[model samples]
Target: MAKQHKIIHVDMDAFFASVEQRDHPEYQGKPLIVGGQPDSRGVVAACSYEARQFGIHSAMPCARAYRLCPQAIFVRPRFEAYREVSGQIRDIFWRYASEVEPLSLDEAYLDVSYTADYNGSATLIAKAIKRDILKETRLTASAGVSYNKFLAKIASDMDKPNGLYVIRPERGEKFVETLPVGKFHGIGPATEAKMKQLGIETGLDLRNKTLAQLTERFGKAGHYYFNIARAIDERPVRSSRTRKSLGKETTFAQDITSVTELTTKLLDLAEIVLESLAKQKLNARTVTVKVKYSDFQQITRAHTLDHSIALGDLREVIPMLLARTEAGKNPVRLVGLSLSGFDAGKSEDRQSQLDLAFSDPF
Candidate 1:
């Protein structure tokens, strides 16, 4: 039999909030929410394990979170502190696998099929990584070990907050069979509700559904659902998956219907996006502007530049793209600018050359 692919998924327990608690020992046992001010027009970024007990979660409105647990500490996000520890965790992952796919600053997938440590056992590697993270950063990381990405991802979530779980190849099918279809990765609340309506409540229930039926209902995602039900996922742990875009956006305290005001905000957002690209060592040719009106309708306009817009050029390009929107006529609640179509392995000068060949003539 061919050797199974060994994969490990690492997720930091309550990443942002945990970092704050680690740095400030006094906050060790308190419910903590890190995000905008409770009264601000923003959402929760991350909450501590304690805060989740109050039914708060990421992306919940901060004001609503406050209403749930009035005593919870609501601090503005400290991304710098979170990112520093993120680096610490990645360093530990690199020690074990040559191919590490970072899903975010706090979580990643590692392919260790041919690893030399622990005689090529992935479970041992996971334990080592969790131990290293605890020792170096004073943080806890949960790990899941399996033979492929799907099982590995599922395994990680089975145990929470600094626990480890494993899904063995021989038991993969049985493990998935008893699992709830909604618990499968990528099945969000909306889809879960749809599944419940279909009476496809468990993996066995999902497996019984014909491909034609699922495809008719869920489209392309049906194929994925069908495969994961059988413990037959083949997606590799990709190390070179390049990011498609980077952006920054903000919500105003009050909607404004002024073109000049919207342009100013996009310029600020463009500067932030440029700094992010520089930090990631990436260059992009496509510039896009996103506008959200007070009515909750949103639209995007993109302009492909002749060359990668240099930091100095974003100010001009952003306004040009913004002009394509109903800026002055629409009361705008949010504005964002993004850059995409990264040309990997190219320096800024070469990327500039490649993009200019296709830049918009207008």
Candidate 2:
């Protein structure tokens, strides 16, 4: 029999807002938002727990967030400060587990299946990591422990804001039975709605569907859904996954038609994409512009250069790409900028380009 894997997913509690509140004592326990100003055409990058109580969430328009809670404090993101703290947290991960897969700056998955620390108890190790993080950084973290990544990720969210929840091997399938299909990590909003239409509201509802039935509906993702419903996930915790693309995009609360407004938004996106590239020390030869019209029609225009793209290059190329589409003439609801052609030397069969969803409200 194959041995079960032990995985722990650690997620920081309201990372950006918590960091801001920690730095400014006056902001503690108060609703705080980290993104652009309420007056600017920006979205909420992150919000405090207090802010969430007012029905505010990330990717919401700052203007709407202001309307939700006029007393909420809005501030720009301090990426440098957040990165420093993330590095510190990563250091703590290394001390506990040799295999750590970081999903983002504030969340990671650690495989402690073979670690003898805490007498090989993944649950104990998770607790220790959480304690160490709070002791060193004065920040709270929530953790989920389970035998596989799928359940582990779900368990992490069961109790949040300095929580540690565990799903044992015996209870994994049972735990998923009552979970809403919408809460499953891989199922997005659109998929959840479709599932609801098909009467797949919970894991048990999904589990009742035969492999053939599910495959007929969800295609390749059907296999994943079928197995996870039974609490079986064979995927390993890959420590060397490479980032293939980095992109940023924003959805406007109201559709925009002005060329000047579109250009301004593109420039803002470019600045953010450039900063991410500089931070990761990466360069790309391909840039793709995504435009979604008010009618929900979406299109993309791409330019591939012989050399890496720079700010000056974007300034020159973006307008030309926009011209290629009917962006200014058409009312657009979303605009995206993506950088690809990262020169990771892996074989084509082994390589997959993953697009990082843009969460920076522009």
Candidate 3:
């Protein structure tokens, strides 16, 4: 007999803005914007619930957000604090089940089918977890209990800001039929518009189309859409997975064309790569440098180190990589640095070296 599946989705409500309000008593009850500086060419990272009432949201231009809420308080983001809180939240999830898949800093899915205390039911477990978060973090969380990740994630959003919802296996298909297409995860604005054009505005409309029709229209994604339309998601909740590669890339605001300036940008990119590696406990044996010209043409140059590479080594190697470039070329528009071929053990050894290098040997 097939085992009854048990999954829970937990999402923090307005995570970034809520964190800001929690730390700053003065920012409470007033509209607050957290992102880039308003004076600079910055975008809104997040805004408080009050700011949402004024149509301020993430990815909106800071200038536009300011215009919408003239008296809004704007502050720079504290990512370190957010990371700390995220760790705490994940630790809380661990008490319930070890099979937790973190989607981001503020959301995760847990499979508790084989839990030590399965007698209580998934819904009860979710409610207990939410209450625990509020008690420990002084923050609110919304939880959804269901038989699969897709339905659980959708149910989690049904109730927001300290909400608890459940999707029973028997009612799953009916619940999905009434759901709007836009509400489905991975169907962003562009896909939603296309779905609307095909008269697929609701899950029911999506179910009406044959799988072949969906595949013809949406390609591989069409298959996923068809399954989701029927509320049948069999994907497992993955807890730990090996990372294939580590890299970072950025698009320039404007094209740049100078080796000296490009070198400077490479330094910054290397630092970002190093910090990410440090957090992930990874060290790379291969360093790849990416260059993009004004015309959007791109090329990559890579160097393999004899031993695991360090950030300082990357700083020294990047300029040499740039020097190998053909002398007579246009100014580069963007520069990126990537470290791949990570050795988990090498990362720990390198971290020890770093610690010793900075230590005061008396």
Candidate 4:
């Protein structure tokens, strides 16, 4: 029999906003927002608990957030500071577990099934981690402990603002039965409505359906749903996840069919993508241009380079790549560009250098 994996998921509470407040105590209890300006086309990247009281959250349009509370404090993101803190937290995780999977700068999953430290108690390790994070950075982290990745991720969200919740194997089945279908990790609003239409509102309701019945309705996702509804997940907490690509896109306020107009828009997107690559200090060997017509028909054209393309060369390469697409032939609604094929070694080196630069020497 395979050993049950002990997993811990740690998610920072209002990470970006919390960092901002810690750095500037005056904003601690205020409704603070961090992201693009309210007057621009930016969206809320993260908001404090105070701002959440007004129904504002990450990814909401800044304009709407402003309308919700014009008095809220807004500021741009400081990625350097955030990355520095992320490194510090990851260091604490490393001391307890060798298998740590970072979901982002603010959250990660740690697998400590075989570690004998703390007498093999995942709960004790999680508590120690939260304590260390608070002592080192003056920021709070919430943790969820479970036997697998799926349950651990879900458990982390049960409480907020420096919370720690655990789902023991004995109660896992009963716990899942009462959970809403939408609350399951992969189920979104659209799937929830579909399940509701089928009279499956909760995990117990979902478990009532046979694998064949679910497969017939949800396709491949049905097989996944059937297992998770039973609180059985075999997925591992992968420690080496690679970033495959980076890209940027924009929706135009108006559609245009002229080639000249399309070129102008594509150029703007290329510049942004190149700037992102420069910031990461990486190079790419492939370029792709995506186009969506006014009718919402989307298509992409890609070009692979014999050599990696530099920032300055993109201005010339973008026009060449755009010519391969159907941008001017139809009214275009959106334009996007992407770059990939970075050398894995270089990317790792760049990340290490960045983490060190942001970390405190003391």
Candidate 5:
């Protein structure tokens, strides 16, 4: 007899806002917003469930969010602080599974099929982890348990803000068939609208379409949709994935035409990219500079480094890359800096280093 596969998806609910509330008791039970400043042409990063009552959501303009919930507490995001909490939660995950794939700062998938203790079932493990997270971080996490990645991800979201849902292998297919297409992870607003236009509004609608039909309409994505509708997912929880690229791009409040102004923007972009690389503990062998002109024309320039270069190195290189461009011909609307071709270190390597260095020796 083959062994059953047990996959778990963990997601932090309203991560940023929840973290802010947890750290500041005064903000508890209030409509808290974590994002950029309202006056700085910023957007809401995340809003408490309370704020959602006013129809506020992530990426909504801060000004609009403020107008909707004028009494809501708006605060800028602190990535470093969030990263600290994330690390603590990750450590808790490591205690249960060796194979953990973090989807973002606030979510991850874990494969515990090869557990050393083999005590209890997957649901028990999920429950225990959630309890530990709440006890340790004073934060809530939702857990989804299932036989495959797709089902596990969906199950986890079935209930939110410290909820847990499970889909056993025998019932996985039935569960998936009844799910709405809009509930699927990759089906965005655009895709859902297109699916509706085709008279396809549910998983059953998607399942009714032949692979050829779906592929014709959605290209490669169509095939993926078909497979997911059937609850067929083969992706594994990968723990060794590394940072693929480091990049920064900025949209301007106003466009600039002068070479000197473009150079200044490029320099700023280089610094931002460098800071990201340092945080990720990565060095890149390739440098890519991208520019979008006010006319919406886009161009890119790339240069390979003889050795892995640091952010400081990029500060010097980006100006040279900008100088090489024909700047006077077009006014620049956006500038971006990207670094690819990372070395062997894994994505969490730098984070682990920081954790180790900061721990007390007593």
Candidate 6:
């Protein structure tokens, strides 16, 4: 058998909120939130562990978060500060592992399979990295070491807030058996519900389903589910992965009923997206419009052209896309626009782009 690869996943504990606390000593151990004001139409970007006790989490509406804990402290995000810390943390990752794959500002995967350090022990490297992060950044981080990305990422979350967990290669397959399908890394809430409807609640339940049965129900993703259920993921840790899409969305505090008003909002969003695209020197061929009704019904309509879409093109295309939705007949609670099918030659410029979260279901 081929040698198993060693991977370590590291995630900062309550990153943004922790940063706020670290900078402002008065905010320490308080119910701190980093996002919009309670009165604004903004959502919680990140909250301290103290805020989580009051049932506040990222993507929750700031107004609702206030209702949960009226005493919670809310502050606007300082991306510059976060980016600086993220860069520092990445520098530490390079000290131990040459192959680093950053998932976000606060989390990354490091492949140490070929490294001769620590007697080729990934667990020791993970521990040392965690120690270095705490010493250098003064922030706690959780680490998970395993043979593949799936298990490594999952192990990292099993023990949190300065945790270090390892899943041995021998126990990798058995470890997934008892986990709920919803707990799987890639399975979202919608997919979890679908899996439950099919009487697949845990990894064992998913593993019992034949490949044909899975593909018939889940299409292409069925193959992925099947392999993950068996803990047989073979995906390599790519140091350079291209981002697929970048866009912006806004959730309204009040529903919008006028198609004209909706069109105006789309234009504003398009301007921001197009500006980012231009700054990145990227071209997009597909435009997607998302509409969420007041009753929580969401729909997306997309149009693709052979040529890159310009602002002038979107001025004409936005109305046609809105016409396909029930914006006038029904109230729209959220509206978003995304540009995809980026020119293959260009990779995403992370520093120049900010992809906000769409309306969160939870």
lDDT, candidate 1, 172-229, per-residue tens? 9999999998789889999999999999899999999999999999999999999998
Candidate lDDT scores, in order, read: 0.82, 0.84, 0.79, 0.82, 0.79, 0.85
- The true-versus-predicted C-alpha distance at residue 79 of model 2, in Å, is 0.6
List clashing residue pairs in candidate 5.
Answer: none
Query: Lowest-scoring 10 consecutive residues by lDDT in candidate 6?
Result: 353-362
Model 3 over residues 246-315: C-alpha lDDT tens digits?
5555546557766777777788877866775675456688988888676646678889898888877887
How well does candidate 1 score on lDDT at residue 133?
Answer: 83
Question: How many pairs of residues collide in model 4?
Answer: 0
* TM-score between model 5 and native: 0.66
How far residue 198's Cα lies from its native spot in candidate 3, in Å, is 1.2
Model 4, 40-73: lDDT tens digits are 9999999999999999999999999999999999
lDDT of 5 by residue, 79-147 (tens): 987996786687667556647899999999987665432353678878888987886577899999987
Which residue runs does candidate 2 get wrong by more than 4 Å? Answer: 241-362
Considering TM-score, which of the candidate structures 2 and 3 is the better prediction for this target? 2
Give the TM-scores of the predictions, in the order they appear. Answer: 0.66, 0.67, 0.66, 0.66, 0.66, 0.67
Q: Please estimate how well model 6 matches the true structure, expressed as its whole-model Cα lDDT.
A: 0.85
Residue 103, candidate 1: Cα error in Å is: 0.5
lDDT minimum window of 10 residues, candidate 4: 353-362
Candidate 6: tens digits of C-alpha lDDT, residues 173-262:
899899999999999999999999999999999999999999999999999999999998888777764444556666676799999999
